[model samples]
Target: MATDDIKDTVEYSEDVKVDEKQNISQHEGIPRPEDLKQDMALQTGEADHELRERERKLLWKIDLRLLPTLSVMYLLASLDRGNIGNARLGGLEADLHLEGNDFYNALSIFYAGYVLCQIPSNLMVKTMRPSRWIGITMTLWGVCSTCMAATKNASGLFAARFFLGCFETGIGPSAPLILSFWYRREEMSSRLAVFLGSSTVAGAFGGALAYAVLGHLQGAQGLSAWRWLFIIEGLPTICLGLLAFVILPDYPASAGKRWLSPEEKELAIQRGASAFNTDTSNFDLRQVKAALLDYKNWLTALVYTGLNAPLASFTSFLPTIVKTLGFTNLQAQLLTIPPYIAACFYLGIMCYLSDKLKQRALFIIIVSMTGTLGYMFLLIGNNVALQYLGACFAAMGLYPLIPLTLSWISNNQLGHSKRAVALAMANTMSQTLSVLGTQIYKTQDAPAYRPGHAICLAFTCLTWGTALVLRYFLKKENASKDKQYGVPGEIDEKHFVGAEDMYDKHPGFRYIL
Candidate 1:
């Protein structure tokens, strides 16, 4: 079939709907009127094969153009955000005269700004061009990160960190939301793995980068290595930010005009619409209210909280934790790389499996259990080898969950406004709790930080248990919906007629279990 034929067929079928007066129950095999129209549009044999080939190419083109750009951006964001831990080992605490709890306070303050800005920033991504918004925030955070090199005292450091968090918030929660616009729900986890995997790479890269900067760049131009660390990592982010304006595609509707042919653009939009059940463009208060009222959002947020508390502490203190294992500061930096590399490989595998099996909660439970066991080793192991092994397990377990949880939450939420708000709310609550993670591994707790390990262990277990509970509830809800409304059929625009305000509540919309 010609591209025009495909386009015309889709448009014609979309316009033609079963009569509203016909009782849906009267149709034995059909679940709803919408399915009749959708089935009419279904193609087979050579035409279907050709369409699938086009879609494959389109996805490949999009992934090449979009994923790497966003992944590198997030990698830079992670580097700047977590480099403070590296800087601490490079003598930041001593240079700044950080007292008891001062370092922790500096770490905690970043989340304060991070938590405050996430919801608003995510909402704004809908109104503004995503490229423009992301570019602007990336530039601002780069500035904040670089300015850390100039800080002479704790006050300056605190101020810089807070603003860093504020601007950095734009990227993390916004990425999955942006990806949702372009990819179908089942495709998200693997792509998000690539995006979120950058953070793991950042951990590995940050360690190597810090080692080089601290060893050679120290005392260069009267600046300490820690100062150089800030400047070196921060400058490239600004360049990437400016480049994002030209490189990052906004939404499929707008992006297709630039990169996709007319036929491809229509297919892309249709794909997104089918995945989301509604193409409600304008922001709706009802969607926002639905997101806020969603018990699943709160439950996922709690799960995120459990994951992030350990995540935050782990990223921020891995160097310190390793140092307590009888390694020098430089050796500790080098040692941190392996765990992150391990995590990167593990993350890719789990995400691929998740996307393949179309599963989220089971994998989340598995990884959370892995992390719990890792922390157990840290808590009870008598030797250095075991403790280091625990660190590797911890990295492998915690890093994968970030992308998994985000995509899981995004997959379940319907409509743009509701998904955006749900993502922001989850991030905000999780980041707020991450402050507790920052403070948990105190300086006094060095060399077998049992309490810290125990706390993280508890949180990981909490994550495991919560995933089970969430999966059960989601399964129960899906069963209940099926019993009440019959099994939902393939949803189309007509299915959303009276349910425009319903978002995910539309009878045809079922939660992904």
Candidate 2:
């Protein structure tokens, strides 16, 4: 829409081409090879890699400042999402005098709203500032969570849950858009890990926070401890919303402040500018269809969905899941902390390695297999520590996949518009599965939960099967294109790094996995 004039460099034009007829992010589109041939001639190896390294450091440092704040923000949001679980432990169901799984019905209803938000919310995010949008959502969800403190019955709880979903809509998908502002596709895996890893951090820390608040604040004034949990947990997010407005960087080219020296800032611009040679955009319907129609989108969706049942079962109900091991709710909540702690450790380390190696699928393979084994042990074995240790394994397994999977998707997508829409769609489809997952493990099916356990086991196998298909599919796709698109010694082809760097610079960017 903004392509009034092209910003011409030595060989390529800055206005990425897109046909308005089709729908997709205005960020990616078809580029002519003749244009790229000229552009590639200008790309200096010494200069490009040097500049890339510099920007990488800048973005890395940005995360050092950014991750803690965002991690804390997301931690607060996630705690609110699951606080209902905490409330159950403190007797929310009985207080409302709900009948026949009405509490779970409330959980399912929230996701109904969450399901509608993915694409539209991100589209709005592209139009607005992410810091502003996310902060607003944060404040709204905080209000919703706080209101939960006053809920009198199941109807009140249901209304709170729906509004909670509505208020919290934009934060998740929009987060990737912010991350893309700084990091290149290749760097996304680890950065994504840092972002999503907060879930693990939150899961563990929330339990501790709940344990402390619910334990000590049980009878404050006329409120129940669960109400206090909502109040205390929801309030910090308000402060965090204000903080994000002040601190989060919007985009590399348009970033406010002189945080980096001019030369360093130039490097950030040049890297993004150079990246346009391969992967810049003008959003349109054809490319949008291209993105949505691609096979990887559905394959990736299936992998994520397959993992969802197990992941939510563990993440949403871990304290209750642990209670089956004969621990009190307090002990169960305390024990839940350790697995998520272990998960955080594994997440940080694995993500670091993913960055260092620039390999995503390899790590996906390992984490999936490890998680499968953990779930298997839970399904059949009975030793308490061993079953509990399976939980640590379970925690470690799920945390890393999300970051890498998201990185894989985000990095491969070419432009801002395409990235935003696809990121939202991909994310929506993934969370859409939560609707099924939450309902699958009915309370009647608890304890051994043979059916639920069997279902999770099958899902792990789905992840593995999906991985195998992806590995083969990517290789085949790359090989066929290489036959047509290959040039002798144009770029390194001997080794592949998870499809990000290869396409981040080229619009011919086809999804490999």
Candidate 3:
């Protein structure tokens, strides 16, 4: 069966019904999508090639219109958030006269506002419209980032950091949620990898940008290079935020008046339903409970917190760590580039294979184990080159887990509210841990940060264990559901739009492995 054939021949209805004659194993509950196409071809009275052509065009339009703009938004968000690391090496700490534990406290304080806003910020992505919510938050964070340049002391910097985090909270959780509104689970992992990989690009860019500013712009305007780094990075983000208001579409079904035609919009909604076996429009308290009550959600949150702690700490501290290798500030900035570059390629390959193989847990485990070994090298080795090699391993392993873990939540949960809350909860827990994580690399632990490396290694191992448990419980639940499917009910036609709960609990829905 060709890809286009499935697109052309399958006429997904408003409610997204599958062919009754298709293999409807109540155990798995969902039909093998490929098995339905021939029957669909007979019913729809359209030639496969004709259908394929149209689908190709529609999907291309979506890809072109959505991905690039979103990628840029994410890249800027990352640079704004992670530039603190670059600034540290560029004289930020010294410029503000930060002393004792003040630098670490400044780093950790950002997550205070970050943890508070996670769930509400995501819920607002529903009511405020993704365009408005995302744009508004971006602009606010940019303003806050620019304000960091003016801070004269640790207290002022702490205040700036908290607000920076409060504004940033939306972007991290919201991007995956927005993607969920558009792409199917199978298609999302790679798209998400691309979006997430932008941060790696930002990491590289921040280093180069900081290096350029430090070398050329230092004392140019009676301000330090770190201040200039903040100004240069912050202003553009504000502009990007303005641009998002014009570019980002709302949910596909209602995103009609913009780029998509009425038919295309319907197709987009139907495509979502066909892939997920539920409507994305449904949001409500009950759905929140569904997400909240699922032990799988909490376990996934735990795993995500474990995975995220190391990644977040690494992003904020990598430049400092690399500087310990006897490199000048300039050399340190340049050195940060290779690990980020390595992580970018590593993320692309892992996500490609993950989507192709239709597996998340195994890849997560593989990356987690690689990270564990990297930490071990850092823990035991004193050789500079060997530890640098370990940093590369850690970067590759640690960063890719973010997208995989997010897409895993999308795979496990259905309905808009449930997906939103699940991602929010996981993000919240992870960000909270990130606060504690930042403190792991204290001044006393500097030079090697051995305790930090050890803590990161332990978390990676815990992440692996949690992933195994999550995979097992999901598999077991599917088997139990498969055995107990009773009388069929009439397929519900009404779409739940923040009113009622309807999702994985529906009889015919199946968990995707």
Task: Give TM-scores for every candidate, taking all chains together and pairing residue i with residue i.
Answer: 0.90, 0.84, 0.88
lDDT per residue, candidate 1, 67-86, as tens digits? 99999999999999999999
Candidate 2: give its CA RMSD in angstroms. Answer: 12.9
Each prediction's whole-model lDDT (CA): 0.90, 0.72, 0.83
Error of 2 at 17 (Å): 60
lDDT of 1 at 380: 99
Per-residue lDDT tens digits for candidate 3, residues 1-513, read: 654566465444455554569744443444455656656767566675776677678778887877887888888888888888888887887778888889888888899889899999999987788988999999999999999999999999999889989988767889888888788778888988988889899989988988898889889779888898989999998998888888888787777556888878787777766555355454578788889898889999998998888987898889889998789988999899998899899899999999999899989898888888888888887799889988988888788898988998887787788889999999998999998788898777779899999999999999998999988988787777778984334323433232234567655555655
Model 1 poorest 10 in a row by lDDT: 7-16
Better of 1 and 3 by TM-score: 1
TM-score of 2: 0.84
Worst 10 residues of 2 by lDDT: 1-10
How much RMSD separates candidate 1 from the native structure?
Answer: 8.8
Query: Which is the better candidate, 2 or 3, if ranked by lDDT?
Result: 3
lDDT of 2 by residue, 49-142 (tens): 8866876687776777667777777777788888788778887788888899797788877777777877777777766777788878888888
Output the number of the TM-score-best candidate: 1
Instruction: Name every residue pair that clashes in candidate 3.
Output: 8-51, 27-482, 283-498
